[model samples]
Target: MIRLIWTLSAHTRYYLRRYMPTNRLLDEIRRRRNLKWGIPAMLLAVPYLLIASICTNALDQGAPGWLHLVVLWSVWNAMKLIIMGPVSLLLLVRARIAEAVARRGGRRDSDAGESVNHAGAEPLLHR
Candidate 1:
């Protein structure tokens, strides 16, 4: 029961975080506003869920001997999802931070170059 509740809570939080406005902020900061990382993630997740479902169904029944092989596979995939959820979120956050730092550094470098140019320019009166 506790495990079920934790699973539900984690899933809920994952969905909620995806829809939050902060996701947009992160995307903008990361310069990946146009990149769709979700596509591949969903592609991988769909096959995983389908295989898991089939394996679970087979296990619940007295299936052919060879089908038993999938029991562990399904369980492993389920556990992978449980663990990947937080790791993916952390990766997204890290990517966003890296993007922001790169952007800031670029801007600072440009500003410094401009300042140097201005200081090197001779005054009209001096000319």
Candidate 2:
């Protein structure tokens, strides 16, 4: 009984977090109003456009009807997946390369007496 209650509470919390409009999240997006985040966000509009067109057509009671809309929605989502996969992979690879370079440079700095002492005493610079 306790486990079930906990599980329900966890699910409720997850849904709220997923759907709620948090100011912090919006503020961060506003702050990062740059190409890095902007391009992908723009790409996301494709799905919304597909949804809008389908809904508009369906409401008109067109010949092909709901089935056509469903197929289009599926295709739109699939295209989004295909388009985003490569872009995301490229971005991830770039980040990894940057991290590797930073680490390599950081090691050189650490070699120049930036390391903490093994002894209980504070680092030489800190003291």
Candidate 3:
């Protein structure tokens, strides 16, 4: 019974987190192909920061203490997005470099094979 309760609670938490506004927004951004959308996604942090600012202002204006949670959540989401942008850019650069290297390597290998075949050598397949 205890194990079942724990499992259910874990599942509930996962679904809750998955559907959170910030997570949903990030999921949408990452759904695009090739991580190309990530560059623009960096701009999303601005709205989160603005939300935090607004909540903070509300708190100062004698709003409910619950607004503190909103401010913290907004700031956390903003920081996540800010950090994701630079990390995604680095990943994109690394991918491009690897692709370029692979292309050059493939071409060099093909050229070397052609030269060997033209040097009057028996084809490896027939041998």
> Each model's RMSD to truth, in Å?
11.7, 11.9, 3.8
- Per-model TM-score versus the true fold: 0.49, 0.40, 0.73
Per TM-score, the best of the predicted structures is 3
Candidate 1 per-residue lDDT over residues 1-127, each given as its tens digit: 9999999999988885577443443343334443334333334445656786786787678677666666565555545544554555666677789989999999999998779769887646778
Per-model tally of clashing residue pairs = 0, 0, 0
Clashing pairs in 2: none
- Candidate 2 C-alpha error for residue 4, in Å: 42
Worst 10 residues of 2 by lDDT: 26-35
Ranked by TM-score from best down, the candidates are: 3, 1, 2
What would the TM-score be for candidate 1 when compared with the true structure?
Answer: 0.49
Candidate 3, which segments miss by more than 4 Å at Cα? 1-13, 24-32, 121-127
Clashing pairs in 1: none
After superposition, which runs of candidate 1 have C-alpha atoms over 4 Å from their true positions?
1-61, 122-127
Residue-wise lDDT of candidate 3 within 10-124, one digit each (tens)? 9998996698876676666554354676767778889989999999999999999999998998899888788777777777777788889999999999999999999999888
lDDT of 3 at 80: 78
